[model samples]
Target: MEYEILGLPAWYYIAMVAKVLVVFVWVLLTVAYATYAERKIIGHMQVRLGPMRTGWHGLLQPIADGLKLFFKEEIIPAEASTFAFLVAPLIALVPAFISFAVIPFGTTITVMGCKIPLQIAAYADKSGGVIDVNVGVLYILALSSLGVYGIVLAGWSSNSKYSLLGGLRASAQMISYELAAGLALITVFMVSGTLSLQQIVADQAGFGWYAWRNPFLFGAFIIFFICSLAEINRTPFDLPEAETELVSGFCTEYSSMKYAMFFMAEYANMITVCAITVTLFLGGWHGPFTDAFPLLSPLYFIAKVYSLIFLCMWIRATYPRYRYDQLMGLGWKFFLPITLVLIVGNGLWISVIGAGNWLGSLFA
Candidate 1:
């Protein structure tokens, strides 16, 4: 069959490349609009207009910002390691882009007598499945952990004391949240009994979402959500990039495209976390009546993910930032122990009786 690339006509590679280009362009555009969406949403919360002068309430704001950054002078400190400084952002941004390749954007469709799956790589393809590996959850955890390295390298290479401090703080923060995040994931693995994201989603098809199954697992999901924010350096846990303290934190020494790379990584990470949340706790691409109409499943999933993203932006605008000490205390003193207890409790409940009976006992 022409399904295999080597057996296909010469135009097959062109078609593959074209598809990639389309997705890449879409992601780039989505990143631009995400900035505008954040500003507009935050502005409403703060009772101030944001970027009105630039193209119809800041619609073109991202374009302007991109152009400005593009034309801006690229600065390198005399004492800094220029190579590492220049390379760090690419290292950060590439993984963010690559991570999306495994994401099942949509299901299979028949076109011109060929069955093509909507994903960039079909799960059946060994190479693409490496991207969509059975160990997807672990891949995400590992990649996200790698994100910290870019910030660290950027800070150390900048040769600035403030940048170095911000990097150190980021390292500590990522480590702390990573524990809660991983533990919360262990709960998911226990419930679904699979390390594969696809299998997890499949397990939720008829049975309702694990998030609503029991209080313990639900609590773990909440803890996971909050810790994910801290891991991504979002507000309330944004100590590393505390502008008043660290002068834009680890990226303080970066300019132009280098600075943009950090923002790209941040937003992309946000999307990834939200998608994973939907996949693990919210039953993934499953929704009411989705099986009856498979084509609509991905849309439902995307909507839910974006809604969560919007909520995060709203919280960022409405709430005051927490003190650094308070941030650490909440993560360590409260969330850590709570999540630990929940995991243990959930395990005992599941083992004593099946998950369904445990749920009935709790509410009955």
Candidate 2:
């Protein structure tokens, strides 16, 4: 017997396709401009000028950069594993795009009298969302863990010492810090009692639950943020690609679009992480007048996400790279232990008082 494909109507497919196109384009544009934002932000912080000639105030710099990379000659090393080398960039970039599938950008909107959620996975209603899954947090974590393999493959396939070392460093760093980051999010899971990101945002409808409503979670938030920095290989924890040491690390032999894909994956991951942070820590899509004006949800979400991204850039500009030993030590000794302790404390708090007691007005 043949299946009827979930018995869904044609309209559902059309609407889903529309949402996919919109989200994909938006994410791609955001990933491109994030590089520009970082350069400009750090430039101002360092009292120097960033790209100013590409367009008016460097507005088109990312576009120029993308085009330049697109048309560049593709080169493959003679001794490289041809298939894996080519596939690595795809592995790196695909996760960054697909992870957005589960992220909720805004609350429900009425389109043709049908309530549609801003999440790519499912439509949101009061009961929950209509997405493919209820566990968005886990979905993100899984996709994030998968992205590192591309780096490892790139390094290993290139058959270069620098690339191999970078891949090794990336694998180790991911294992070291991902634990603390995962544990830190336990605070959110415990308080929210669900792994659905959309639901987590719904629960944080106050002055941001992790920000003010629950003061204890703030510490874990910092730990989570630091761990995220390591996961994304940002400046201070960028040992995997430390230019001074590894000569471009995993992408040492990669050039043209392959090299570009690495950076694209990085920025896209940045956006994904910041979006997760907003959903779990900050009140997502909930700002002034959000109650009265549901249309403002996307704007609020975007504002909060960019604010977090800006904070990441600030940290990048201000902090110096940590020694490899110090990096491992911080992850293992400091962050891991602290996250465990915070989990225990949050468990106790939840058992005794409950989150709603902290800010009774926040629950949806």
Candidate 3:
């Protein structure tokens, strides 16, 4: 049997390992700081100082928080299932981190007369990302759907009424919103004619970004954003963790680093959703000078993601939490119908004008 990848020597595995390490470290750092950014931004929005004492305006607040959690006493409920309770956070957290594997962060760069992808993996000469699978969208959807299990298990295993209710609400909420979110993205797949996220980004290169190029997709983008908020349990849709009611919801029984894992998972999911949004609607890594200087692509991508994250924070500060019924209504009643209409309308429009041709027909 021959052992090779893309006809490269076995030593290539070493490079792949190094790339994975880099991405994992990068994502961890980003997730940590995203929490700090959220608190600071929301504090300022409410006319209050946020995290001012930790390190020069709380620059090192994430680090301090991490250390605090690390040293905290671990607690497990006497009545909880020993194993499932212990592993629930890992199940929740790992999926959020892995979802970023398929996201295209930047373009390829030439180094020493050889092309190197900014992401961990590449498909021959086509696209750069970590494992550019044919069903990239499906992969993400599957992993995201799996994240609900951790919450459900945590809630059920805890034997607490509040935790169980929180878990049930989370599962129902996520399932409802996932349908709308998937339907919203169907328009993008219909137009792009492929499930590969990197290809979707490639289709939007130059001035052909979907959000501006197709008017219908702008609606889809909005739908996606709303559903994403519900999916991530952000403010205005945070029924599962309603402090006034559920007492921290499904994680009521968790403490120490296990609790921190759930917290990190939430922020990590936020980062993943923001990155996916940038890739799908805002044109991942596409910007002025991106083509001329490939190194600038990542900068553009990260800036756009940060902007979206700030918007999420702003909404958190501005809006009160929705009642549970209202949250479910928004997903099932509003976003579902809207996304279905947009999907059908987009499909018909694409069928009429053809993929990547709508832009030219508008000016014609």
Candidate 4:
């Protein structure tokens, strides 16, 4: 039985608040340092010191940058749509953070005679079993797709030709790649037989097959990650904000904290992409020694997430922007067909292996 307080379980409220605080702060800090890390990593790759003056090898740069942006003057284009211009940033930002609510960051933890899941949206049932948001995958997809609206609004509201073009490009890119990303995850859903992200991680245990070992999952992982980069407008797929072309794309007309919000949204989405990749493609929170020392689970999860984040940074440092035609061609002419092939091949493989076998679960 659960203890009730104000018609809700005490654990319920406590868990809810705790989950919000922990996940929010964790994601915020990660986004902050990710900027710093990117600057330093890319700087070093180019044989230069990144930010030596901002406190010991630029350790305080993110904070300093935040402070600078906070204190900076605000500006709205005289010709811009005031209401939409202001609302655009909030729209883009809220989804990036709120989507994490369904992410299973770690397995579980025991404290004060209760087991609390690390995911923000999950709750415990009467029997104390964990209950997660059943539509975690769809929730993420919906929120992610919603964010593109803000981009479009920002561009259109700005009343700038460049911003409008950038916004249009972002929407187009999102449409093209979002399908590939969703199709890739269909394989994951087929294999896991559940939309709950926590259950998907649970299913990947002991196999490590999802990461790279199993051919079908490995294919899905590759497509998913590639599409994720495109979805987030990362370089090699970043035609929307091609600096030389659109003067920073959809954000060209914004300045100060408003722009900072968009900046933060991009990194936050990057973190989100990395987290979901870890949860779906990699065995999340299940690294060695986590079984014995459950506390190690989140650490393992964080490590894997950062590793993927580092890869993103590395790719950004190295890759050139793709041309608009090239981007569309790659998505339609290439990725779409490949995803379909993977799905059909996965079905055939599962049929041959038989669902009773562990390998057959790739499409079950």
Q: TM-score for each prediction?
A: 0.89, 0.94, 0.93, 0.95
Instruction: Give the Cα lDDT of each candidate.
Output: 0.78, 0.86, 0.85, 0.87
Worst 10 residues of 2 by lDDT: 1-10
Please give, for residues 278-303, the per-residue lDDT of candidate 2 as tens digits.
87888888787877788899999999
Arranged by TM-score with the best first, the candidates are 4, 2, 3, 1
RMSD in order of candidates: 3.6, 3.1, 2.9, 2.6
- For 8-61, candidate 4 gives per-residue lDDT tens digits of 688878889988998899999999999999999999988999888888888999
lDDT of 2 at 264: 96
Q: What is the lDDT of residue 55 in candidate 3?
A: 83
Better of 1 and 2 by lDDT: 2
Clash pairs (backbone) in predicted model 3: none
| TM-score, candidate number 1 | 0.89
What lDDT would candidate 2 get against the real structure? 0.86
The TM-score of predicted model 2 comes to 0.94
What candidate 2 gets wrong by more than 4 Å, as runs, is 1-6, 124-132, 360-364
Model 4 bad stretches (over 4 Å): 354-364
> Which 10 successive residues of model 1 have the least lDDT summed?
123-132
> How far in Å is the alpha carbon of 130 misplaced in model 3?
12
User: Judged by lDDT, which candidate is best?
Assistant: 4
Error of 1 at 144 (Å): 0.7
Instruction: Write one digit per residue (lDDT tens) for candidate 1, span 1-364.
Output: 4445575544346545655776577677777887889998888878898889887777889999889988899899999999989998887787777766655555444455444444554433433332246677887888888888888888889999988998888888888889888988888888888776666776666546788777788998898999999998888788888988889888999998889889988888788788778888887777777756767876877787888889779878877777877878888888888888998998997887556524434554
Show how many residue pairs clash in every candidate, following the order shown: 0, 1, 0, 0
Is 1 or 3 the stronger prediction by TM-score? 3
- Regions of candidate 1 where Cα sits further than 4 Å from its true position: 1-3, 6-23, 124-132, 356-364
